[model samples]
Target: MVQVDVFWSYALGASFASAASRQLKIKSNPFQNDYFTYTLLYLSCIFAPSGIYLLWQFPHWETMQVATCHGDLPAWLVTIFSITNITQGILGFWVSYQCIKAGRYYLAHLQWFLAYFCMFFVLVHGWDGLGWQRFLYDPTVLNNQLWEPGQHMGLTFLWSNVAFTLYVMGIFVIPFMIIPMSKWIIEGAQNSPEVRSTDIPESIQEIGITFLKLVLGCSLGGAIITSIVIYIIRLITGNLLISFIFGMSICLVSGYYFFFQEGKICYDLFKKLFLAEPATSQKEKS
Candidate 1:
């Protein structure tokens, strides 16, 4: 939870700072903007409130090579951790500002995206190198039987599972959602100048299609990008950061085109199969 909230704080800072940046045809969506801030802020600031959460909750995993117990959490350590989160948020904002000012909006997204994912990797694998220890240790899990009558792994096990699940949704899953595309849809509503009290969809099917398109488009884009990038990186330098950097760069550049195309494909299919037209469209052609 400590790592998760802190990461969201940084990501929230970066994502919000990318305001007013221009893409070729892309305009920021008002609804998407509010939604983004609301979700991230609610999880990060409102929930645990990172700083206080750290001081009171203590840390399970060794962060920066230091470990502390719950009740004995050093004020100084908490202070430092809190400072780091603050500084990280500040830095994220700074980086995003520069990126957006330079017309590199994708880099701004990368700032937070990279931080959260890197920390996630560290949190999972770098917890005394025992992240995988509990998973395969269970006899039932190994035997392909997940649940049993008696399972006692204590608070460490319980909190780790619960926290990671929620964090994954907040940090990873939410980002891949078609918030940006929905923003474009909102832009269409605004520019059209037709009567519209709201451009955002209120129905489940409409919302589901947006998310479904985002996932599929990004999946296809990711697979293609990975294949090309791995080949090039292997031929050059096979650094982990280099791979990640390349992956994000391509996603912003050529990858976006693919997302747009793939999203169109999904939406067209949905339109043909179910939706007569956009659910929000009330204006009739004369």
Candidate 2:
């Protein structure tokens, strides 16, 4: 039920800002435009939701170019899918913006991570090659073809894949570190003196490039380090899941330091960007 959509990414991005916002928190809202939140929220709705709709409606749309099922996707489905993605994003902004207005930090965090965590299974199992079924419903998570660049290694051989470790860590795991990282940011931000006002991002119509930079920075840093940690653990643990599990815990500690690890290259880049302000006056701004 918990679809891996932009919702999780948005939540993570929001949490990152919100957690850091605790530092910027004033008794009153800054009421400034938060392109970060808006960008993530919008991105989440567009890519994952409509993308999933296309995949579901077409079944194996990825294979459509060569497969006989290419014509199954209807123009109606396209219309509906586009409609739903936009509407869903708008609805999400409404609800999340309300929570932010009310300072319900934990409530918003709960909404995202609850579903985000489930994706780890999909990430792991997905590379397990074709015929991988869920324990209960027995659904095909992946239908990897031999001609495809993907390999046929299930969980058994997958755990030891160095490249695969890097791939998953970069795209999914490191970005995932945002959840815990945001938790710390929230706590850190909250501990500061309350501010007078802050902007509700959704209320504003503005855009910028920082959101992409911020996500990529942390994801890049977190992924590289975490992948190394997982690989090291893999050498000792000799199991993909176990190695990843341990690596995840390691990321928790790393996440905290990354926010403050000055001059440390990749990790600290996240800190610099996360804690950055476009201008001196923008400190308390979202």
Q: What is the C-alpha local distance difference test score of each model?
A: 0.44, 0.41
lDDT of 2 by residue, 1-286 (tens): 1123334444444444344444333324332444344434544543445355435533332222222243665767545554554444444444444554455544443333322333333332332212122211101323432123333334543443333433543464334434434444534433433322232122111111233343444444444456567768888978988887888687857665655344555333333223432232255563
Per-candidate clash tally: 0, 24
Worst 10 residues of 2 by lDDT: 199-208
Q: In candidate 1, what are the lDDT values of residues 1-286, reduced to their tens digit?
A: 4444466467645644542233221434322455344434443454335345533443433232133345455778666665555555655655665665554544555565555544444343333333333222222222422322233344454455334544654564344333543453344334543424353355435654644443344443344445456446645876756754675577556644643333555334333212222223333533
TM-score, each model?
Answer: 0.43, 0.39
The residue ranges of model 1 lying beyond 4 angstroms of the native Cα positions read 1-7, 19-51, 58-68, 131-286
Candidate 1 TM-score over all chains jointly = 0.43
lDDT of 2 at 173: 39
lDDT of 2 at 81: 50
Q: Which residue ranges in model 2 land beyond 4 Å of their true spot?
A: 1-3, 6-49, 56-207, 260-286
Q: Clash pairs of candidate 1?
A: none
